[model samples]
Target: MLRITTLLLILVAISSCSNKKTETEPLTAEHKAKIVGLSKDLIKSINDFDFSIVNSTWSNKAFKDRVSNITGTQKSVFEHIFEKDLKRKIKTGNLSIIHHINSTNGAASFFNLDHKDHHSELTILLTYNDNFNFFKYRIEIENQKPVLSDSYNFRDNLWYSEKIINSLRLASKHNAFSNDRRETNIAIHNSDQELLKGDTLEALYYLYDIPTTHQTGNWLSFRKLTLAQSLSDSVYASVMVTEYENNKSLYMKYLYHLYFSDSTDLEKVYDILSEELGESKTLDSLVSSGSFWD
Candidate 1:
């Protein structure tokens, strides 16, 4: 009887543990609801140009910490550059009013909850009238609240985290180029930063002041082409297409054209591009997406 009682107690304890594990195993529906709601709020903030609300939803501190870990103590400097330059540009009306948040949610995934770090990757389709773009956000839990930690735009094919780090590295190199070219570097960095924000025209405005000599490159040409394509400026896009096609340098290739060099790889790149960019305004299938890594 004693042995049977001990066995029964152990069994009960084991069952309780199993149930507890099961409870936390799946992403709770409540958590999913919170994430979806948070996404909508973020989109609204961006559309409204309320950087205060945008700042609240994003963990810039978390971003800085991550950047510090990777780039080593340059977070403050990078943040300063971003704030000063981008703000000045906005005040001057270079950046356009971001359009509405017309989006259709896609897949959402949850990962690394045990570490108290929740990576909620949500893919969604963002439409601006007839043109469509794919955007993905990686929402993470920081301080018991959900915040956007990183984002990836299908157009750029690069995450914002990567964009900032790269921008910081280049922008901080004061001796890398002459003063004029240094300004160009800053402008290029600013342009790519705007691209991350889904502002094609403002991004182009940053690039516009770049010296004519610095303007010609496979990467720059392709960047302009995609931005032009997004705005449906056929004439500008045609000029960019010509420049992109005629460029011979193999050095600094856009990710979009990297695959097109070979037949087998081209097919794979095509399928993914088609899916991400959707069918409308595909430049007649010549160029479906309209952004690239800088």
Candidate 2:
């Protein structure tokens, strides 16, 4: 009787541990289905030029700080520019022209999801009319609803975090310890605005002239490389590659180098990029048209 009681207790403990493991598992099929549905709805809303869905998902702080500037009724430098441009394009029926170029209707292809505690990350291969880009969202559960805290855009082996803090930082009147740094930051911001407005050459030359002491970041140098690539100025791109030696994506650097190489080299690079990106036709169109935006 004593032996049987001991064995029973051990069995119960094992069962309890198994139950705990199940409870902590990141995502079950049902949760995944719900998340995917949310993602699809977000994409559809964007395609229709309804930004409400995008705004609705923003975390409390992101919503308050990202859409408007520090001053009253002044729109964010980043959001205002892009949102206005997108709305204009939609109104002018320019989306159809872009779609014709890519031969693809904008679609959301779910790539990955990682869940931890009340936080989750979702990465999707998003086709935004003319571009195939990766959209990654950092989501957190608040009031039992998923809200976006931040997002990162991955394009052509370069990464851009859509930071709302730039507006606040730029608006602040406080002087930095180094005046040179402050001026450089302002110059870079202006250059970014030009790039957003499609003044590629102006943006490239302006950024290129910043003093090396203040332009120490690899991202700054990489930005020049992208602009040069867009303009098909391989000579300038080669110079940028030397400055931006620590870029995370070596293959992307190689692709840029080969983009203006001999025909055989171009073919080989295209095959490698297509295999890696999984969007051969879209890439081909973008390259052929010589209008790859950052």
lDDT string for model 1 (68-170, tens) is 3333335556667657773344223211223334132212222112222245666544444334445666666665566665566554566666666666665
Residue-level lDDT for 102 in candidate 2? 42
| TM-score of every candidate relative to the true structure | 0.48, 0.48
| TM-score of predicted structure 1 | 0.48
Candidate 2 per-residue lDDT, tens place, 125-213, comes to 55554445555666654444566655554433322222333433444433365666666777788888898899988887677556555
| Ten residues in sequence with the least summed lDDT for candidate 2 | 17-26
Runs of candidate 1 exceeding 4 Å displacement? 1-33, 40-55, 68-73, 82-117, 172-219, 222-270, 274-294
Provide the lDDT at 47 for model 1: 55
Residue 238 lDDT in model 2?
69
lDDT of 1: 0.53
